[model samples]
Target: MEHIYLLALVGGGLIGLSATLLLYTLGRIAGICGITFSLFMPQITDKKWRITFILGLVSGAFLIHLLTPIAIPAAPTDNIYLLIIAGLLVGFGTQLGNGCTSGHGICGIARKSPRSIIATITFMAIGFITVFVLRHIWGVI
Candidate 1:
């Protein structure tokens, strides 16, 4: 648990630093969903930045694996149909929310946006309720 905490701290600091640097240098928000979505849009003129950003994300994770001994979590025990439905629900939620956890929780909240605060709270509460329903109420643990 202590190791997990330390790892999370390091990962979070890296994310925050990367977001700040991107914001300072590019005059843009470092929201991955926004960045990624922009890449697929027909109006995107310069694709290099988006490609590089995604590559950096993948390479950074690869570098972390090279430097650390983190183990991958086991595959979900839930049925594939259920997982697909959950994924679709999450995607819909993300679209409806206008941003994801990292976008709203990290960047938006950091900027002191009231909408982000509410969105983050709702996201977390829903997550907590889902876990409680799964593990306790539904006995799915």
Candidate 2:
């Protein structure tokens, strides 16, 4: 348990450090959703950088999986339709909020952006309510 906590702290610190470094170096916020969404924007002048950045994310994940025999628990079983609906809801929420967890929760909160703070709080509240409704109130899952 202590090891897990230590690993989590290290991982979170690395994420924060990397995000800060990216922001400092690129003069762009380390909001992954924004970076990814920018790919479709007409004014995206640096496509190669975006593509390489995205590729690095994928490659990094693959490298971690290969280097560490991590235990990824099986996803909780749930109704397929409900799962799809939830996914769509989350997508809509991210769009409406102008960012997702990585954007608001990670980088935004770290920088103390008021807008991001509100969005993060809202996102977490919604998540908590949804889980409560599904598991306790409605017994959906």
Question: What CA root-mean-square deviation does each model show from the true structure?
Answer: 2.0, 2.0
Q: Estimate the lDDT of model 2.
A: 0.82
**Residues 45-124, candidate 1, lDDT per residue (tens digit)?**
87788789989998998887788787656788668877887889877787778888778989999999999999999999
lDDT values for all models: 0.85, 0.82
Q: Give the C-alpha miss distance for residue 45 in model 1, angstroms.
A: 3.2
Alpha-carbon deviation at 127 in model 1, angstroms: 0.5
The segments of candidate 1 whose C-alpha lies over 4 angstroms from its true place after superposition are: none
The positional error of residue 73 in candidate 2, measured at the CA in angstroms, is 4.3
TM-score of each: 0.87, 0.86
Candidate 1 collision pairs: none
Write out the backbone clash pairs for model 2.
none
